[model samples]
Target: MSNVSYYTAEGLKKLRDELSQLKDVERPKASQAIADARDKGDLSENAEYDAAKEAQGLLEMRIAKLEETLAGARLIDESQLDTSKVLVHSTVKIKNQVNGMEMTYKLVAQSEADLKTGKISVDSPIGKGLLGKSVGDVAEIQVPNGIMKFDVLEISRD
Candidate 1:
């Protein structure tokens, strides 16, 4: 059974575009490289040919993995998302209990997580600890440094 990956509409579209590019552009380029290398010299001891073949293999493997991920992906409807508790796509405001510093983050899919933009992956340690938590709830998350506590102040969909 394939585990379904929840993605936003934009994320799914991005995946599709990437797959198309890989199949149309990269795949053909790899094949052409192999063909050119093979034409250059003898097959038995041609390092260039071997390297081209290896690169093609790696490219095909990447294409296959992307296809598999797309097969199990499902687009999440933003309008249907619940805002009462922390969940994927929810922008949550939290306060560090130890330092009283407040920060906001949007829990998103792994593909869309960008820390510089305050988007965090749902599978991340802090995100996992915040999932399903409500306002006034304190979430304890184990990090590389040590355990940290966060107080959930608000949950909103943006």
Candidate 2:
């Protein structure tokens, strides 16, 4: 089964750029290294040749994985998203019920998740709990530490 996932325009572009770099630059370099090693000595005993072959195999595997990811990626239309509830690509401000601390987070695809930037994957515990929650709704998330409640303060599209 194909694993379909949505991505923002910027995120899609980044994936495409990385794929291009791997195919156009890294692939050629890997091939050249193997060729150079093969020409140096016998393939049976040459460690350099074996290392180059292994590196090329790894490079090819990475390229194949990237291609698969791109194949299943769909671009998300930000304008079409609803601002009334938390969803993928939603920017939500939530206040911790216990500490009264407020934090804003953007729900994004797994590939685009970056905690430092406040972008969390939709598959995450907090994101799953917050999904479909409207403003003023309370989300009880089951985290690794324990259960934590967050009050939805606002939902916006960014």
Candidate 3:
């Protein structure tokens, strides 16, 4: 099965930049480390050589994984997103039913989720609960503690 992922333009660029940095910069550094270690002494007794080889293997694995992610990534057009309801890339303003606290969040792809920036993954508990909900609808999200209700005050693009 193919694992497809969606990303915003900035998120996609960040991924591509990371892949390029790993392949172009880190790959050669790993190769050089291996070569340096190999030149030090006999292969059987060289701990540096073993360590270098292991590091190279890890780097290669990371590169391969990023390549796969990039292959399956699709860019999302924010302009085409529906603002009438909560969906991926929707900037939603919600009010806590119990505390009366209001907060805003932008639902994004899992890889791009950053709470510090008010971006939450669509796969998250709150995001999943809020999906398909329109303004004035209440979302009951089940957390480890209990169910928390959030009233959808507004939904917009951007």
Candidate 4:
């Protein structure tokens, strides 16, 4: 069975938009490129044709992957989210126990995780450690660098 991905309404819409673009625009462009290449020359000796075919294959693969992702996606209503504990779509404030540095991040799906936006995937080390934790709880997260401790300060839905 495929894993179910939880996403905010906006995130689900973004995925749908991307899928639509890939299907309506990119797929046709790839088909046109392949057709143009085919008109150029012999199949075995044509490098342009080979390149175009390869590009088409890559595009189809991406489309298939995106379709599968969209199929397994479940949208979460932001207004109905519980803020009492850390969960997907929850903005969590935490303090590094070792350095006393405070940081905030929103738990999001892998497709929507953007470091610049302070969103982390629930599959990430820190996000996994923070899941199900409430305020005042200390999470021990194992990152590539090392294990770090963070004290949960607040949890809210944004």
Instruction: Using TM-score, give the best candidate's number.
Output: 4
Please provide the root mean square deviation of candidate 1 (C-alpha atoms, Å): 1.3
lDDT of 4 at 146: 91
Residue 26, candidate 2: alpha-carbon lDDT:
95
Clashes (N, CA, C under 3 Å) per candidate? 0, 0, 0, 0
User: Which ten residues in a row are the worst by lDDT in model 3?
Assistant: 1-10
Q: State the weakest 10-residue window (summed lDDT) of model 4.
A: 75-84
Query: Across residues 100-127, which tens digit of lDDT does each residue of candidate 1 receive?
Result: 9999999988877899999999999999
Q: Candidate 3 lDDT, tens digit per residue, 1-158?
A: 45787888999999999999999999999999999999997999999999999999999999998888888889988898877999888999999999999999999878789999999999999999999999999999999999999999999987
Could you tell me the TM-score of candidate 4? 0.96
Cα error, residue 36 of model 3, in Å, equals 0.6
Taking all chains together, each candidate's TM-score versus the true structure is 0.93, 0.94, 0.93, 0.96
lDDT of 4 by residue, 65-96 (tens): 88899989998888886788899999999999
Where model 1 places Cα greater than 4 Å from the true spot, the runs are: none
Tell me the lDDT of candidate 3. Answer: 0.92
Between 1 and 3, whose lDDT is larger?
Answer: 3
Candidate 4 lDDT (Cα, 0 to 1): 0.92
lDDT of 2 by residue, 92-139 (tens): 999999999999999998889999999999999998999999998999
